[model samples]
Target: MRQFFVFARKEFYHIFRDRRTLLILFGMPIVQVIIFGFAITNEIKNADIAVLDQSKDHYSARLIQKLTAGSYFRIDRNLQTPKTIEAAFREGRIKMAVVIPPRFGQDFFHLRKAQVQLLADAGDPNTATTLVNYARAIIGNYQQELNGPAALPLTINTTVRMQYNPALKSVFLFVPGVMTLILLLVSAMMTSITIAREKELGTMEILLVSPLPPHLIVMGKVVPYIVLSFINALVILAMGVWIFGMPVKGSVVLLLAECVLFVLTSLGLGILISTVTDKQQTAMMASMMGLLMPTVLLSGFIFPVESMPKPLQWLSNIMPAKWFIIILKDIMLKGSGLREVWPQTLLLTGMTIFFIVLSIRKFKIRLS
Candidate 1:
């Protein structure tokens, strides 16, 4: 512990001495968050949707079959009742829900009009909007086929409802994503670069020659960064909530705890990077190329993973940012608790342990 503090203090002094490093440490996340908050768009494909058919009539079944046949929506749930839509949305199961009222066949034939309700999860507003439009277009085509060459009195009205983010604010999506990207780059990139810099300066050998164990030496080096990254997380969270109107619908403590866990995971990844490279430039390159592109592309930060090819979708499972972003959205937007996010939480914990153990073995091999 005494040795840990000494090394930690040394790192603090080293960090403060480098002006440019300090700027990146604290300045970058804010700029990125603000920038990404306003930036948005994409096509929705194979989005999971739900169908609640109270009418259970021929018209309703035909409409559902028409909807299921299209490429835009996949029927994720054939709900028995309207009551389940909220739970489905909260569980992140279905993106949209179609409710067909009872007596659909009667209403269309006798009353000459029918109504269907569309409940879309607007967590990603563009997705919700696009899905609703797709469903409507399919419904329109069906209506045209039914009424072709003659003016029919029969009509179908769609009542649309947007859940979660009703106003479709892009900030809701970007804040969580930017938080994941920044935490990853800051913790992993900086840790790897700093360790590699020590190796480049030949100071790592002096530290290794000390009475302290190598693991503790490495731990001490990362502890300060863990603190700094955690602070960076909090700062970004504050900016997200206070500046961008982002809400912490779940427990704030749980959210912060997650941030710390992700920071440690990122730090472990950084340590792993440092073990493979001996130069700051090499470490920076690895962190940027290896971490940045994957986190941005594969993590569902920019593009929906479901929209990617099968190989890429399967490959994204290995990207830690992919899981972290899901956890963040669950906690921040869905108001989910440990019971809700436990699977992702467990995956992240496993990843943290994996990176640490693998880095340790590699470090031992290098030392020997």
Candidate 2:
């Protein structure tokens, strides 16, 4: 027991004494959370738009006012002809152009319907789509205001209730992803690099030949990282809740427990990586290629897995971060319980066991 404690203490000291390790262990999470929270967002704001209001009527002007009143858009140019609308988009001056035909107010008053064309740049499809949607929603709202009590006879009212995230804030979506990313990188990449570094420095052989058991030595090295990873998880959660208005809908204890599970899984993966590689640079490149890319791209973090092809979707199922992110969203947003997340939990447990066992076997072979 005393040897174990001493080994763990030594590992902690080694980590703290290294400036680069200290920076990654503490600094990376803070920067990632802040960047994801504030910068990387789906919400469109202050988007430049051009208007081709041939009507120049009160109704058209009011609709334009309503569109520009919110943070979504700003009218950068007023187009006189249809030719200029394309020119505005081509010049990179605007993302969308709203064209209201002449007699728009008269048509709305007499014919009860009017035509408005929304021309989007389509250079960036997602942004263009979002801009068009925002414009349509504003126009729809204006129409509703104009047609008060005597609702249009055949108009079907489809009330969309956005559950969990009513504001549609991208922060809610990003928080879980950022948490998964940070934990995976810190626990897996850093641990692998640290272990590989020891091997490279010939310190691992000295530790192995000591009185301490091999498993104990490995455990001691990993324990400090576990503690650090957990602290990072708490920091991210705190920032999500207090700074970004992210809700903890379920039990905080359950959330933390799940985070610990993910940390252990990542640590096991790191151990496996270290067992395979003899150099820190090799381990780092492996970790970045093996873990970071998949976590960012295929884990349903930035893109939807359902939208992916069948083979890619199957590939994503193996990504541990995918399951962790799902568990996070379920618990943090949906207020789900153990029963709801048991399948994902089981998968994570299986992965952790597989990684740990593989790493042990590989380490024994290397020792032999």
Candidate 3:
């Protein structure tokens, strides 16, 4: 007991006293969360819009007035000819163009059907989709008031209530993804490198020859990191909740338990990598290239899974972080409980067991 405490204390001292470790442990998570929350997002606001109102009537003018009144778009340039719409799009000055055909108000009052053409830049599909939706909603609201709601008998009433993010901000998604990445990098990659360093320094042989059992030594090395990573997870969750107002719909205890399981899975992965590679440099590189890269790209952390190439979609099924991110989002955003996220929780648990067994086998091979 005393020896385990002493070794654990030594591990903490090594972590706290080292400047680089401290920076990675604390600084990387904050910077990653900030970059992800603010820098990387799908929300498009104040997009430049150009108007080509040939109608020049009350109806056309009012529609333009409504578009500009909303914060989603800004009318940057007014055009006299149809050619300017293409020019505005080419110049990238405008993402949307509203062209009101001749006699728009006359047609609306008499025929009760006026066409308002909406031309959008589909170069960025996500932004384009959002912009189009916003434009349609604004125009539809105005049309309802003008034509009377009852007359448009073919009504498509949408009762959409955004559960986790009412504003549909992208940061709510980024927070959990960033937290998963940071936890993986710090816990798995860092632990692997640290273990490999002992091998490179020839200290591992000495430890193996000592009275401490191999599993005990490995546990001693890993316990402090688990504690450190738990704190890191807590910090990110707090930031997501307090700063971004991201909802925690599920039990906080369940969320933390899932986080701990994920951390253990990552640590197991690190240990497995460390056992495979005799050199610290190789282990670090493998962790970065093999685990970190794929975890970010294939996990649907930044990119939507539905939009990914078919093969990559199939490949994402194997990525552990994908399951983690889904579970976190379910718990944090949807307020989902164990019943809702059990499949993902089970997947993570199965992966953790697999990694631990693989690492053990590899460790035995290395010892032999």
**Candidate 3, after superposition: displacement of residue 172 in Å?**
2.8
lDDT by residue (tens digit), candidate 2, 83-188: 8876788899898899999999999999978999999988899999999999899998899899877765697777899999998989999999988998998889
- lDDT computed for candidate 1: 0.86
Candidate 2 colliding pairs, count: 0
The TM-score-based order of candidates, best leading, equals: 2, 3, 1
Q: After superposition, how far is residue 80 of candidate 1 from its true place, in Å?
A: 55
RMSD in angstroms, candidate 1? 13.4
lDDT of 1 by residue, 1-368 (tens): 88788879989998989899889999888888877765543446688988899998788889999998866789888899778889988999889999999998788778878888899988888788888898899988887776666763796767887777775676788788889999999899999986678788877778777887767777887888999999999999999898889988999999999999999999999999998898999999999999998899999987999999999999999898998999999988889999998888898999999998887776742342
Using TM-score as the yardstick, the better of models 1 and 2 is 2
TM-score of 2: 0.95
| lDDT at 64, model 3 | 90
Ten contiguous residues minimizing lDDT sum, candidate 1: 36-45
Give candidate 3 regions above 4 Å deviation: 149-158, 161-166, 302-315, 364-368
Report the Cα lDDT for candidate 3: 0.86
